[model samples]
Target: MNFRARGVFTLILGSFFVSGIAGLVYQVVWTRYLALFLGHTSYAVIAVLAAFMGGLALGNAWLGAKADRVTRPLLFYAGLELGISAFAAIFPAYYDLVHQAFLAVVRGLQPTGILRLSLQFIFAGLTILVPTVLMGATLPALTRFVTRSLAELRGKVAALYAINSSGAVLGVVLAEWWWIPSLGLHLTLFIGAALSFAVGLVALILSRRVEALGDGVAPATVTSEPAEQFTPRQLRLAVVAIGVSGFVAMLYEVAWTRLLALALGSSTHAYSLMLATFISGIAVGGWLVYRWKRQAHTLAAFAVAELVLAFTLFVSLWFYDLLPWWFVKLAALLARSDPAYFLYEWLQAAVCFGVMFVPAVCLGTTLPLVSRV
Candidate 1:
């Protein structure tokens, strides 16, 4: 990449990092807020998570296909960011109105659990789908924008993933430790919206500047090959691998969270820490792939990483099985003394980190490797 292109790519990645933070902040705040109205149940968690992931999948499949067709990708990207901000700005009021209405009607009817759960899903889906979908389109749009050629694409994508995941880590930490606690939900929402809006403004300005430089043609179409370049077998394998990995990773995340709850207390603090540690592994893995630039060995590396991840996770299950015993021993030693809570929390954190960190890192590394392939 030329110096100017590199500079623009850097800016794009930085913008994405900020946007990632905004996205996670929205997830943390909105989920908690909705739970207040819907009541805390496994159904509520499933509804929220489904809405978030479903929106992303929709955006990725729909908008991603269109990203490469846009003449000014940054303009498109900026518009998407603005859309997310607009939704974020309005969502609080919308959700409150919807939740209250639903609660009143459901209370009058005294609905069954399934009916109530379905209603929660519908409300959560409606409240979050627009912004979350817009957030999802960002990866494909920004990836298409930053890398002008196929050769540079993988590295740029990996780097962007790294920075974005790092931003998520920061967001989770801040939301738990500072933002939600200090700013409260409305102000926190506005803050995230502002960051996203600022990113959109910056992208709009850059789009115009690039246009002024006479290289403003549809960037995404420039010398890019279609997926048909890969053989049918390879394409099928890729699809299968992606699906398997996603399913496995998500299942593992839920299992690990439950296990960690036994070690740590099942507070928001513990949940936030768990997410941060898991995502940090992904960020580190992406950064490693970007820095190493070893695409030739990506397939082998990915396979090895997957094996390592699977093995480590299985081993960690055994550790979890023994964790309660270990916790009791440690607790007895502490014996409700001063700093007992602090030390216990620290111990929980350490145990959680030790068990998941390596497998999560391996999980993270495999993603970029697969993307590279």
Candidate 2:
């Protein structure tokens, strides 16, 4: 690739890595650490996860809607970096404070279960909203930075998505195997925050240079028909499909974990494996979409994959305990003879392949179609 191409590619890849680590820190490390310290009540962890995702979706929608008017995308990124840094720097202290507060509440009036749960939800929501919202703006901002033409936009977007997903896989492996276990959650968050800040600084400097070289011309904005212009039926269909696929994929993943946990008689490990598998599937699906050329056919293929994924989830849910006798016997034998970590790992792989692959393929294909429209 030429120099500009190379530069854009590097930025995308670096952002991918940083964003991936940030997500891992939140989803895997922070959630586990908080639950461990705060008690595993669904009120605590699930509330936090929902808050983060909700903030992320809202942030993405906001950024995408106003992307064209944003003259200083780098500044937004810098703010994200600063926000993350502040959050990380305070995490240890904040957790301690929250824990102390929880204890005080328990001691004082002895709140009902519902009241405690409400408190947990509020606390979790405030703690996670900032970083998640910042992260949500990233892809749209990066898309604005890298895209130079309507024709090339889809490929550029796909490349960035693929790199980020790949980074997510690495982040999961590293966080689980090394960071959380060795460095601890606080330090891991700090490291991720530092990386995010560094990337922002670099992007800021580079963007300045690009502006200088352009002799005052700003970066080109994405060309799309205004919202006031009615979207054609095909475009509407594409958007609906993408949204539906994404929602179903997330549901399938959660269901898969619950099913596996029940079958395997282990909840925590089964959940982790499901998450890792789903992330890996997204990475693989992204790469495949990046390589695929025919947009219309790609969409069709993705639709088929979504159907398969839905079928798989339905079957798994319906057949929750009906595994062949030999399979259960084999599991029991392995559990008796050795640690059953391998079983969870294998199940994780199966779940990853089934749950992640199809919807990811479908989602990946949608961007290209939208860009084409």
Candidate 3:
């Protein structure tokens, strides 16, 4: 990359990183707030994730379809960031209002479990849909804005995703270990808002500068690359496979989370550690994609990764059966130790890592590879 290309890449990467941190901050706090309102059940977690991911899927495809058409995508990205910041600033209050409204409406009717869960999901979905959709658009907007040449497009997208994933790792750790503990959810939300607003302003300024630089020049071309040169039927099949991959990945994540809670004590720190490890694996996978993009075969690598992931999932059951015996042995070994609880927590985290890390890493590789396709 030349100096100017490198400069633009750096700015895009940094902007996305800031946005990623703010986005995760909102996710962490909002999910906790929703859990409180809806009751801390497995269904509640699923509801929140479904709402969030549903918004993302819609927004990603919606914005991605239009991203390349805009002459100044950075300005569009700036608008999205600013809007998300505004939403974050008011979300806690909005959530409370929505929760109260839901309760009042359901007071006369003792809804069944399934009905109640559906109601809760609707309320949560309304609360998060707008901001989360905007969050989902960031990748496409940045990808569109940063790719000045066809040769650099794949690498640019991969690198941007890797940077954002790395930032999410930081966000998860900080929100768990520091932000929620130190600032509380309300304050943390505002802090995230500030970060997001800052990114918006920076993007806006950069957009104007770039526009001026290209004042007399022809517009930069945007390529509309299809997933791959497959028959329409094959393309349809690939889409179905991608959907299945997403579903199975989320299913495994939910299962692994519950398993971790069982093996480790159901402590906040334990949950945080598990989440952090999962995100770290994603960051590693994105980095690998960017670092080895030239050598990577999207379909072949994804297929092998999926097979390995399935094997790991099966093998994990055998390890799960052994956990009780090992925990018993560890507890007995540390019976007289003052920091026995701490030691056990660490061991539990290690076990969780061992069981989930390889699969999570494989799951991570799928994103950038799919992006290239």
Best by TM-score: 1
Ranking by TM-score: 1, 3, 2
* lDDT (10s digit) by residue, model 1, range 99-122: 788878788978787887777678
Per-residue lDDT of 18-40 in model 2, one digit per residue for the tens?
77766665666666755665466
* Worst-scoring 10-residue span by lDDT in model 3: 214-223
Judge candidate 3 at residue 334 and give its lDDT.
73
Stretches off by above 4 angstroms in model 1 are 41-44, 104-109, 211-230, 331-345
Candidate 3 lDDT (Cα, whole model)? Answer: 0.76
True-vs-predicted CA distance for residue 124, candidate 2, Å: 1.5
Residue-level lDDT tens digits of model 3 in 60-136: 88976677788888888898899999999998789888988888868967687889877877887788888988888
Write down the lDDT that model 1 would get. Answer: 0.77
TM-score of each: 0.90, 0.81, 0.89
TM-score between model 1 and native: 0.90
Q: What are the RMSDs of all candidates, in order?
A: 3.5, 4.6, 3.6
Better of 2 and 3 by TM-score: 3
Q: Model-by-model lDDT, in order?
A: 0.77, 0.62, 0.76
